[model samples]
Target: MEHVVRLEQVSSQLLAVVRRRAGVRELSKIVPEACGIVWNVVRAQRVAGAGRHVAVYLDDQINLEVGVEVSTPFAGHGEVIGSATPPGLTATTTHYGPYQRLHEAHEAIRQWCASNGYRPAGPNWEMYGHWKDEWNNDPTQIVTDVFYLLVADGSSS
Candidate 1:
């Protein structure tokens, strides 16, 4: 899949998430479960203007947090917890297809970082836009934004 990777600055944002440690294959089940938990919390709290769904991958073991963006931090309860998006320089790209095709967008960002002399400094994440009914008919209409935090000055700490 063709992708356009760009270097951008990201601001820290609040999140309501369900943290889990699962392999890549398990994410298909884990993500939806987490989303369900988070959405219920959002509705109960009556948080207006909640943003898109997000999955923050902290490691290969899939230390993941399935979440939705919130305007401010809140006390977490049960499986749903509060977190913040990492802020700084990042390599970003948008994937326009089904979730299964998301790996291509990640690979594209990795290649962009390598060729551009940047190195991943931290975990990466994906922000999924609001779902559309038409996406069922044309999966390519689905949108997901991928972000990889980059090391400052390309230096290893």
Candidate 2:
């Protein structure tokens, strides 16, 4: 498993709301659909950051968190109707090929963290950098960035 950690500039976003009780199947159903709709109709760009953190957050909602946010940059004016921004400081990685294969990308990060003696922090995120459902006819061309926040020393896994 390869691992990289980096800092990101902070940003803000306006978001549409959706709520779901905690669980992978539930999240899987809700998030992909919401993101797909937002991507196809709204034409939003994918957010960047780490992957593991998002998974941990999904599994553990210690803090209030949003998943797979859709956004546009801040223009210092009234918020655009469909514009949005995700909180920054995420660990991000591009997982190519089918979206289902993203599970491996995430597993790589988790293994990297364990081998390196690092703990994951709060909830992480996944941003769809590119989704060309029409052209590719495969989710492989779909690019997703997953984020996992780091935990302090001696934290729980």
lDDT values, one for every candidate: 0.89, 0.47
Residue-wise C-alpha lDDT for candidate 1, range 1-157, written one tens digit per residue? 7999999999987999989888778878888888888999888988876889999998777898888998888578777888988999999999999999899999999998888888998689999989999999999899999999998675533
After superposition, the stretches of candidate 2 with alpha carbons farther than 4 Å from their true spots are: 1-14, 36-58, 61-90, 152-157
Clashes of each: 0, 23
- lDDT by residue (38-138, candidate 2, tens digit) is 33333343333212112224456422233333343322212222333345444456676665567776776677667666566655656656445563676
lDDT of 1 at 142: 94
Model 2 CA RMSD to the hidden true structure, in angstroms: 7.1
Error of 2 at 22 (Å): 4.8
Query: Pairing residues by index, what is the TM-score of model 1?
Result: 0.95
Per-candidate TM-score against the hidden true structure: 0.95, 0.56
In candidate 1, list every pair of residues with a backbone clash.
Answer: none
